[model samples]
Target: MRILIAEDDPSIAAGVSASLRQGGHAVDAVTDGAKADAALRDTPYDLLILDLGLPNLDGADVLQRLRKRGTGLPVLVITAREGLRERVRVLDLGADDYLVKPFALAEFEARVRALLRRYTSQGAPELTIGRLRLDLPGHRAWIDDKPLELTAREFGLLEALAARPDRVTSRAQLVEALCSWDEELTDNGLDIAIYRLRRKLADSGTQVRTIRGLGYLLEEVKEGKESEA
Candidate 1:
């Protein structure tokens, strides 16, 4: 899962980022609401962990803006406020889940997983990029009529990439998706995974393209098997 952590406290932000990364999720941590809003606007994230205390803009304002723009991204609010009214307000403001400050890391991770499970089960129960299709609910992938067997890591990489098909995802993001914060994941490990996944995807005539210096994009092939524009 790709998550956005909108936290201002340096220590707390680091801890949250590390914990989420350790849980095999790609995380982008920001210290202010403006940066957090910008990140959400530019990227396709599976989940969001937002703190009420933020600079340049308040967390509530950020949530309000996102809703106004009709971005229904799943949001998990983490705040120090422990009042019943505050919790209700955040929930009513469009947050999918809430965690009080000094929350247990295990609880936080569990909530995140729960939200993702619910999100993936909705819609068509499948995500598609041209002929490539992933049955999110069934945890299956297909290239039109053929099933493509994929390892856990490969499947995770495919979901992260194929979720926002046509967009590029960085190597660092994929590394975080495959390995937790404490895991010693080398760049080569990601490369190897990509190489294996590419071979698996070859049958679809769709390829994972490397953009020289930036990252990778899962591109579908045209009738002649040419890469998508």
Candidate 2:
């Protein structure tokens, strides 16, 4: 998952970034709301870990603007503002979850995972298409009771595909979801990732079908059957 951490405090930002990166997530940390907004506008993020105290536009304003433009990016407000009213206000402004400062890294990680799971599953943890099962929080994928060995990128791709089964995911979107800004995302890179994922998930009967003019779509490929498209 690609996460944007908008925090003014350097220590907090670095800590959050490192923790998230170690958790196998692509993180982009910004110290102010303006930079955060720019990042949001340019890239597609699965989650946003925002601090209320921002330098430029303020966290609330950034969120408000995003919502105003109909961008429903899931946001978790990580702030020191523990007051009841403050929490209520942020929630009202469309923050999906809130975590007070001085939190344990484990708890914070759990919260982020939970929020992403909810966001992707639309409030459900288990996403199933045919016999394939995806446990979002557990970061596990199963097919017919057998677990598949998938790299983080492959797992991310599968997760994204499972979120909208049978929906075509453009190469660009898949690249964004699976790679960080620093990674070289080429057409061949996506192809290679898909190839590896397909091989590992052979038994699952899930195939990454390439649409001639569009992109790739994940669907159940019957045993001994192939996609004509």
Candidate 3:
């Protein structure tokens, strides 16, 4: 999934972004609340990790504006403010979960998974597209019961394509799903990612097909056809 982190502290932001990337998520980060709010408005994200002590616009105001806009996006607030009233206020502002600073990475990740699972369709954590199986909480994908060796970006790519198996996933959609703002997706970079994914799934029952002008599609491999698109 794609996540946005709104934090001013570089250390904390880098650490959290690395952890989430290791778990197969595409993460973008902003150092101030204004940029955070702008990213939230422009990008499609599955979760938002917000810090309260933000410059320009505070995280609470960000949350307030978010809710006022009627966006139901799940938010997980991470902050140094440990007061009960602060927690209550943030929750009242529409944060799905809150984690105080000095939190265990394990616990933080668990909260992320829980929120994602809770909001997923029918609350189903596992996504099955033919022989390909995805465990969102576990951040793993398998084909024919065998785990597919995939990098974090590749996992994000697969998830994005699988999210719309019957329809074409546009290049912009894949870029949004797989690349953060810092890691821009050039045309060659996109082609390399797609080539790598196609190579890994070559022998699987499915294939990634290039759609010429549109983008790409994931479909079952037909009999008497080339495996790679």
Q: Which candidate is the best by TM-score?
A: 3
Clashing pairs in 3: none
Global fold similarity of model 3 (TM-score) = 0.90
RMSD of each: 6.1, 2.6, 2.0
Q: Write the per-residue lDDT of candidate 3 for residues 1-229, one digit (tens) a residue.
A: 8899999999999989999988888889999999998988888788899999999999999999989989899999999999999999999999999999989988998899899888765578887765777776667888878998898778888888877858999998998888777788888888899999988887777888888899999888767777764
* lDDT rank order: 3, 2, 1
By lDDT, who's the top model here?
A: 3
lDDT of 1 by residue, 1-229 (tens): 6678899988888987887665546678888999988987887777889999899999998898888889878999999989999999999999999999898888887787677767874645677766778765345788897898887678878876776577898987777666533455688888888888888887576778888788998877767765422
Flag regions of model 2 displaced more than 4 Å. 223-229
* Segments of candidate 1 deviating more than 4 angstroms: 121-155, 161-191, 198-229
**What are the TM-scores, per candidate, against the unseen true structure?**
0.65, 0.86, 0.90
Q: How many steric overlaps does candidate 2 have? A: 0
C-alpha lDDT of residue 220 in model 3: 80
Separate clash counts for every candidate? 1, 0, 0
Q: Please give the TM-score that candidate 2 achieves against the real structure.
A: 0.86
lDDT, model 3, position 44: 79
The CA lDDT of each predicted structure is 0.79, 0.81, 0.87
